[model samples]
Target: MNLKIVVTNGINNLIKEDYIYSTDLDFILLKFISNDWGDLCNEDKKFQNELLKNPNSKYEYRFMGVYLINNIKVWIISEYNYSIKSLIMTILLPEEY
Candidate 1:
């Protein structure tokens, strides 16, 4: 996927609360989307559907997933803005969301 990614200001606040560096969030999102590991698994499909339901709504639309990037476990919650063609992602602890 060649989608553009933007991290929202709210995500910065969450990062600080989560004790995660902004750079790590950028790296993980880039790596995950750039890599073509395989077709979407069932879990991914479910998440995608959830994300698409109200992607353009005023309220944030979130889809949660766990990803391993550079041997680190990353919990991600993201919203896709179809109008702008971007994915806005936040890195959170699995228990945070």
Candidate 2:
């Protein structure tokens, strides 16, 4: 996708909490940028697609992907906030949200 990968606060937390390997982190960001949606079910994937099609006021653009790391499930989310003129991406365990 020739996309720029963002390393967000949640990713920093993932590194500290899990000591996650670089390769796994690479896969997560790559999959996220490529729209691979790792472990998401069809319904969740559909929601991601819908979000892209119809973003809300809070987030001008957004995407979510689920992936498994050492048997632990995590979610990666990226959002563009028009108000702040920034793009933010995050990764964390679902419960953290």
Candidate 3:
């Protein structure tokens, strides 16, 4: 798939609404587009267990990955739009998840 990225208006609104910090935007884009990341498994029992253990904890879903940027762990969420051949990625604060 030719995965082009589109940061939707919702993500932009998050930034504008202060749900996502402005400074981390570049780092999010860099890591998301990097080839060294792995996909998240939504059905993983271990992952589900952890989430169940802490409902307030932040987590990422399909095609998304948890990454450590600047010594802080961040979640990057990616939604693929097959119709447009694009992937929409949004970076969020843990609390925002």
The number of the candidate with the highest TM-score is 2
- The worst-scoring run of ten residues by lDDT in candidate 2 lies at 1-10
Candidate 2 matches the true fold with a TM-score of 0.68
Error of 3 at 33 (Å): 0.8
Better of 2 and 3 by lDDT: 2
Off by over 4 Å in 2: 1-19, 50-59
Q: For candidate 1, write residues 37-90 as lDDT tens digits.
A: 123467775666665567453235555556654444556556667677666656
Deviating ranges (above 4 Å) for candidate 3: 1-23, 38-61, 68-72, 83-85
CA lDDT, every prediction? 0.55, 0.72, 0.54
Between prediction 1 and prediction 3, the one with superior lDDT is 1
Identify the superior model by lDDT, candidate 1 or candidate 2.
2
Candidate 1, residue 74: Cα displacement in angstroms equals 0.8
lDDT of 2: 0.72
Q: TM-score for every candidate vs. truth?
A: 0.39, 0.68, 0.40
lDDT of 2 by residue, 7-66 (tens): 556556767787576689788888887778998899988877776665362255567889
